[model samples]
Target chain A: MGRKQVWEQGEVLASAMRLFRRRGYLGASLRDLEEATGMHPGSLYRAFSSKEGLFSAALDDYNERVVEGRVRAHLRDAEDPVAGIRSFFTSAFDTGGGPEPDPGCLLTNTAVESFSVPHVAPGVRRGLETIESGFADALTRAQAQRLLPEELDVEKSAAQLLALYQGLLVLVRSGTDAAKLHTITDGALALIRARNATAKQADEEEQR
Target chain B: MGRKQVWEQGEVLASAMRLFRRRGYLGASLRDLEEATGMHPGSLYRAFSSKEGLFSAALDDYNERVVEGRVRAHLRDAEDPVAGIRSFFTSAFDTGGGPEPDPGCLLTNTAVESFSVPHVAPGVRRGLETIESGFADALTRAQAQRLLPEELDVEKSAAQLLALYQGLLVLVRSGTDAAKLHTITDGALALIRARNATAKQADEEEQR
Candidate 1:
């Protein structure tokens, strides 16, 4: 593709991703996609083959840009990996103060919407596994830093964090208050903190 | 309505509930509802006014029958409320060894699907709130029984459990393995267990 065509294609995929995240798979009609992407039906089908193909592309874009970006920012690059995980959870909610309700994570929305579009199941699973693995990596680092107890099952806790992440997204999409979600996030992180040897040492030092 | 008519209506709602749970809001078309309920479109409209109306009623049925039933079975009536909460989480998965994939909880499904069907938002919130409150009630009882530390925040922990519950359902629908889900559930309950004075005391007694 030419340079302009490549840029346009990226823009179209981004638009499609927003629509899918907001309306879900079945909820976003072909006509809706056309409108959102500013592309004609003939051009859309010619480009992406079918609505499912377009959706899969959009989901791929989401996993690469959104999911991976968050993982890198909060888990891999952050100084404190556990703190990064907490930031990762809190980051799902929009802090922009926009009037639009939170549309939730595209991976989570697709996972729930996969009941209708089973073809997207593998993509949804891939995105979720990415987050799960990110958590595992972060927890392992946290354990090495004495931020977590040595006995903590990093794999299982990572899986739990994945579930908790998805669950918070569900609440966000369901119009849960941000304050409430914050409290839940804090409580969840505290569960991890309670298992932190460093945190226990700090407590002991303070008592002394 | 006559007794027979009432019985038939209950049956139809159950069928509709299952269809919605399986297919989500927009995924379950009018024809699908007709086939599921064995009611013609005109009759369905006459009975429930519109698809949205029918969906509202079905959600109400779910909250009453499925949500409330689970709460009573695993939370209210169980001898140990903490164990009851654990059972409530596990109960979301199908243990029957059926070939059919888990349909997940209707409440979580509807919450995710509510982006398209905003009318069902209240019912979804109500169902989630019921579970959160159920968790709170159980935690309070556990604390009263000295099963939990007096300093544990019941409300915040309940909300965290609510998020965890919804997240697990998302994973379940997304086709995560049951064994993985069980481990996540156990880890979550252990967080609560870590806050259990009774459990700690029992550990101490055993060690002694």
Candidate 2:
């Protein structure tokens, strides 16, 4: 076997993340990790010293490269920044694959479970901030190009989007049907677009 | 203990709920419950039987009392249904104590951590459904009073409110300060009101 096949660090972390997403920190055990990742306990520990350590590393990797990437990748390929934002919400909230929605963003799951738990809180906070920054960055670029209105509060709006994303995750987890998510995400993005248009009109009127 | 105190079988459940709120189910333990509630393991088992049973009871109580009561209480007192919703979102997102806001809403935390877990999913669903029904009931009442336009979709709007509320909880958990939440909440409510006004105006215009 090739060295890459022997050392499946990314693959192992992904499996652990799925478990963490389903069962939280205390909910998940080392044995669960072993079962999910197909690694012996010794092999898992050699890769990640403790369960907490493994979770943290998985979160960092997922946030930077996977979850944030999902949003960033959407923004990168879209011709219209507005369309990008719109599509981002759709993909994030709309449960496409099944009758019942899957659990929401794993990062969100970790954040909710990490509140007073010190071992996991920092990692969760860091991942969320990174995701927030990514949204703000995209928004900033969109505004500079005159796609988004001048008076739009990107930071607050970004915060709102993050909240919106988190809330949708809760909805999906609670077994809210895909149709419910579709409407909610639609209403949110509609408000976003309408508000920007209204702000721009107000600015133009002020200039006149 | 006073005679009234003798009937407080639910106090231990309250303590357990607080612990579950502060720390997730897997994070909170029988030992933790013993320390927090000052009940011996035998007394606790006599009262609740198992950790899962205690959680089930505590969650049921919270949904019926705290989460549902908060929303129904808002609707009960407001002059306008929209105003009532604004107040509901404000209070639901606010954690009562904490120097920096420790991610409020027990229902939300439970939704995130327990929805996919085998035992707690039903309770979490019940909590969300109760909250959603709060909005639906309020909107339906308003429609009966001719406050919302006839063409307005009450079921859809309630679903949106549910989505928004859940999303806001995620926002609260993700460390959104009140100021940020207020901004988003205001934007959302204003849009709802503006849309209603627009639809009414369109009806008047069409009649002319």
- Isolated chain B TM-score per model: 0.87, 0.80
Task: Give Cα distance to truth, residue A91, candidate 2, Å.
Answer: 2.7
lDDT of 2 by residue, B28-103 (tens): 8789988988888877787778888888888889888887778778765556776677778777665566464553
- Give the Cα-based TM-score of candidate 1 against the true structure: 0.90
Model 2 docking category: acceptable
For model 1, the superposed segments whose C-alpha errors exceed 4 Å read: A1-7, A194-208, B1-7, B194-208
The per-prediction i-RMS, to one decimal, reads 8.6, 6.5
Residue-by-residue lDDT tens digits, candidate 1, A1-208: 6535423878999999988888888888998988899999878988899999999999999999989889989998889887787788777885678887666688888887786788989999999999988988998899899987786767777888888888888898788998787766664565554442132332342231
lDDT of each: 0.79, 0.68
Best by DockQ: 1
Q: Chain B of candidate 1 versus the native chain B: what TM-score?
A: 0.87
* lDDT per residue (tens digit) for residues A16-134 in model 2: 88787777777778888889999998877777888878888887788777766776776654566655765676777554666744535766777677654457666676777766666
